[model samples]
Target: MANNDIEVGSRGSLPRKDYFEPLPAPMIDMEELAKWSFYRAIIAEFVATLLFLYVVVLTVIGNKTQTDPIIGGNLCGGVGTLGIAWVFGGMIFVLVYCTAGISGGHINPAVTFGMFLGRKISLIRALLYIIAQCLGALCGCALVKSLQRDRYNHYGGAANQLVDGYSKGTGLAVEIVGTFVLLYTVFSATDPKRNARDSYVPVLAPLPIGFTVFMVHLATIPITGTGINPARSFGAAVIINDKEIWKDHWIFWVGPLIGATIATMYYQYVLRASAVKAIGSFRSTPPTRH
Candidate 1:
């Protein structure tokens, strides 16, 4: 999800001048279905997503358990909101690092959706990847439930909920903006052009990606519980199965999806200046024969 997009596209004028090669992945690359690497990538996505959801959900439940004196027996307060943010962010950093080589480390559906819109991945691959991620997330939450059904049920399954004061729209807004921050960071971090031009600059892709998630959660956790990743939201919702959780469920999916779309367009047209490149290509003069 961070560092492995193919680079073969229009290198207008001098290859160095183009800055990026935008190869639109085929819409239906059936050939990928036959490859072992494709299946390998799918499995990687599954396990990575599973671990991501598993750890984050567990941390959330644990924090709630400790914070409530009635339940925790005055456990000296739980790992507060700050700690929860760290766990989410830290786990992302660890998981992305671990699986990036295998499946580009796409543990989140929003990241995969953004990549799809940018044509970085084939439609078939993107679809399957999303399915695998969602299932993995479900299993991860289910794991937490299986281990401590009472505790899990006690903590409301850690499903994202719109806080008491916020309106549904406000909750939706946070999800969109939070996801935008995350997806935008993903695009900027994995930019092939930046990587090529600034080869000497030492930067780890996973670091920023993880930090973006952490920061977004910090700001929006109180709003919509920060559903920047659709798969993350979906898993928790499915496992919890409480009627109340379903009330704002649409916000989780819609907000992240819309945010991803915006980020994809913003990166391609505004930040990357794809529009400028197109106009330049149309206007450039052909060299006359010597």
Candidate 2:
């Protein structure tokens, strides 16, 4: 009887459910996986960029142009400049949420190339990302062409070019300043140290990044239509097939890449070091666990 009691007690004391041990941190070396992971990320970036361009171009074409008045004499829909900015900004908001984890949400070839130049990304990965971005842009342009069809002749698909009376110098300046602001925001928002607080990481980054694009459009729409992202400009320009736009496209790519490179350097050498010091201070203090 005593033996039976012991067994029963032991059985009762045992946990009702098995305790689960956490899976070990993934053993894949980052360097070893870098090549393949980057390619996957590039593909994700491409898809995301394509979605962004397609949505924005379609909206612009459908809303902005004056199609023949309906039988009842009314415009179907019209999204003005501000509305267009919102649409473009909103698309970025969605894409970043979807793709940030996969590719750091760099849907711009200039950004990818800049990071590569800064040594933040490997050369193999950068090439793959550029290829993906270009292909994605082409796909997006093709979609816009198909959707608009006959209307395509009237629609420029939101292609970037200097407005009449705006000089090449003015366009270059706008692109440089706009891109610098954007890259700076990207660096601040994504730096793990700056966004170390649990609440900020996933939520805040997208907002600022999206807002930056909106603000850029607001400021530069008249001057150059704000080609802060070269992939965006390329996508639209390809659809428009404007040789003049293509000739000036170098400014978009070069300016953004320069700005991103500068921002990355500042973040790495100055901001990151300060962040490390700040985090270190917290770590040195003993935690009083309850």
Strongest candidate by lDDT: 1
Clashes within 3 Å, all models in order? 1, 0
The residue ranges of model 2 lying beyond 4 angstroms of the native Cα positions read 1-36, 66-77, 273-290
lDDT of 1 by residue, 1-290 (tens): 11222243344532332233666789889999999999999999999889988999999998888778785455557787888899899999889888877788878888899998888899999999999999999999999999999999988888998999999889888888888888898888888787665553225888998998899989998888888888888999999999999998999999999999999999998987777755554334532221
lDDT of 1 at 73: 50
- Candidate 1's C-alpha lDDT? 0.84
- Model 1: runs farther than 4 Å from truth? 1-20, 200-203, 279-290
User: What's the TM-score of each model vs. the native?
Assistant: 0.89, 0.76
Local distance difference test values of all predictions, in order: 0.84, 0.71
RMSD of 2: 11.1
lDDT (tens digit, per residue) of candidate 2 on 1-290: 11111111134453222212122123233573546665679779889989988888787776656443642323544766777788878888788878888887888876676566545566666777778887888789789888766666565667888888988888888888888788778777775433323335667788888888888888888788788888888878877887777888887787777777777667655765534543453244433322
For each candidate, C-alpha RMSD in Å? 5.0, 11.1
